[model samples]
Target: MRPFLIALWLLIMPQVVQATTDVYPFESASEQERFRELISELRCPKCQNQNIADSDAPIAKDMRDEVYRMMQDGATDQQVTDALVSRFGEFVLYKPDFNQRTALLWATPLLAVLGGLLVVVGLVIRARQQGGAEPPLSEEERRRAEQLLRDRDGGV
Candidate 1:
C-alpha cells in the first residue's frame, strides 16, 4: 500500500508542479524578474492563502495573464497592482496597504492577545485575593465539626 501510494504521488506531482510554470516571454531579464516578483506578491483570490506564483487555481491563471498583459503594455509594478486591487478589491494583495478600511484586519490579532492577557491577569489577581484568607466557618458549624472530631477520636 505504501509503495503504491508513493508511485501514485510520483505520477501526480509533476503535473501539479508544472501547472504554475506558465511562462510569458519577457523582453529583458529585469522585466522577467518584475513579473516573477509581481506574481509572488499578489494573492490568489481562489486559493486564498497562496500567492498567484504558487497557486494553481483558474483565477490565479487569469490574474497571471492580466499581469502579463499589463506589463507588456508598459505598466509599472504599482500601476499593475493598483489595477488588480481596483478590480478584485484589496484582498488580491498579499501585502495590503495599511489603510482605514483594513485597520481592523491588521489590529485584530494584537487586540485579541491583549484581551487574553487582561483576562489572565484578572484571573491571577482573583486567585491571589481568594488564597490570601481562609473562608470563615459559622459558630454552630464549627461546634458541630469539633463534636464530630471529638467523637472520631473516641473523646481523647
Candidate 2:
C-alpha cells in the first residue's frame, strides 16, 4: 500500500509542478528579459499587492499570455503597457502615473510627515507659551503635602 501511494504521488507531482510554471519560447535572451521585466512591473488585477509574474490568479495568467502574444507580434513595450492599461486600467501598473486620480496616493506620505511636524511645532509653541512657573502652594496644601511625605518616609 505504501509503494502504491508513492507511485500515485509521483504521477500527480509532475502535473502539479507543470501547472504552476509557465513556458514561453522567446526568440532571444533579450526578448525573454523584456518579457520578465514587463511581467514583474505589472500588478495582478485579482491578487492584492502581488506582481503578475508571481501571481497564480487566472487574470495574471491571461495577462502573461496576452503580453507574450503582443511581443511576438512585434509590439513595443509602451504599446503593450498601453494595451493592458486600456483593458485593465492604471491599477495594473506597479508605478502608476502622477495624475489627478493618483496624486493623493503619491502625496500621502509627505502629507503625513508634514502633519506630524505641524503637530510637534504646535505642541512646542503651546508649551513655550504656557511657561513652567508653577504657583506657590497655599498653607493648607503645604501641610497636606508634608503629612504625605512624612507618612511615606515612616515619620522621618
Candidate 3:
C-alpha cells in the first residue's frame, strides 16, 4: 500500500507542476496584459493563420519569449513587431506591412472585386444588346409564320 501511494503521488506531482508551467511569465500585470495583446497580433511562423498566443508550436513559444524579452527592454508594441518582422520577414506579422513588395497583397482583393464587376457589367450589356437585335426575317418567312398561326387558330 505504501509503494502504491508513493507512485500515485509521483504521477500527480508532475501533472500539478505541468499545469503551473503553462502560465506565461511577466514581470508585472501590465506587462502580462500587453504581452497578451501583442501575442494575439503576431502571427505564428510555424502555423499560418494562427496567432502566436493561440499556437502550440515550438516556434510560437520562441516568438512569445522574444516578445516578452523585448517588452522587458522597454520596446513599444510596434517596435517589437518591427524587430520580429526584421528577423522573420513580413510573413510572421498577422498584418503584413504596406510597402512596395507587399503592395500586391493589399491591392489584389480590390482588383479582383473590380474585375468581377467589369465581367458582370460586360455580361449585362451583351445580354441587352442581343435582346435588342432584330432577327431580319425575309417577307416569305414572315408569311409562313403568319399562315401557320392562322391554321393553328382555325382561320384567324
Candidate 4:
C-alpha cells in the first residue's frame, strides 16, 4: 500500500506542476488591465476560435506568458502585438490591420452579397420580361403540336 501511494504521487507530481500558472507582477492596475485586454484580443493559433486568455492549449499558455513578459518589460500594446504577428502571421490577431493581403478577407462577403443581389435583380427583370412577352406560334407549328399531343394520348 505504501509503495502504491508513492508511485501514485510520482505519477501525479508532473501534472500538478504543469497545472500551476505563474502570476506576473504588474507595476500598476492600468498595466494589468492592458495585459488582460491584449490577451483577450489576441487569437490562439491552436484553439482557432478562442482568445489566448480563454484557451487552455499549451500554445495559448506560451502566448499568455509571452504577453505577460512583454508587458512586464515595458513593451507597449502595439509592440507586443507586432511581435506576435511577426512570429505567427496575421491569423493570431483577432482584428488584423487592413492591408492588401487581408483586403479580400474583409471585402469578400460584401462583394458576394452585392453579386447575389445583382443576379437576383437580373433574374427578376428577366422573369418579368418573359411573363409579359408571349411569342405566337405559327399555324403550322400549332397544328403539329396538337397532332403530337393527340398521338401521345392515343398511344398511352
Q: Clashes in model 1: which pairs?
A: none
Candidate with top lDDT is 2
Q: How much lDDT does candidate 3 score? A: 0.87
Answer with 1 or 3, whichever has the higher lDDT: 1
Q: What is the lDDT of residue 71 in candidate 3?
A: 88
lDDT of 2 at 102: 96
- Candidate 4 lDDT over residue span 1-156, tens digit each: 999999999999998998776577888998889988999999999985999988878999999999998887889999999999999989999888999999999999999999999999999999998997779999999999999999989955
Question: Whole-model lDDT, candidate 1?
Answer: 0.92
Model 2, TM vs. native: 0.84
What's the TM for model 3? Answer: 0.70
Estimated TM-score for each candidate: 0.72, 0.84, 0.70, 0.72
Against the true structure, candidate 2 has what lDDT?
A: 0.95
Write candidate 2's Cα lDDT for 52-83 as tens digits: 99998889999999999999999999999999
Q: State how far residue 125 of model 4 sits from its true place (Å).
A: 0.6
Worst 10 residues of 1 by lDDT: 14-23
Where model 1 places Cα greater than 4 Å from the true spot, the runs are 1-20, 136-156
RMSD of candidate 4 to true structure, Å: 4.4
Which stretches of model 2 miss by more than 4 angstroms?
2-15, 18-20, 154-156
* lDDT at residue 66 of model 2 (Cα atoms): 99
Best by TM-score: 2
**Cα RMSD to native, each candidate?**
5.3, 2.5, 6.0, 4.4
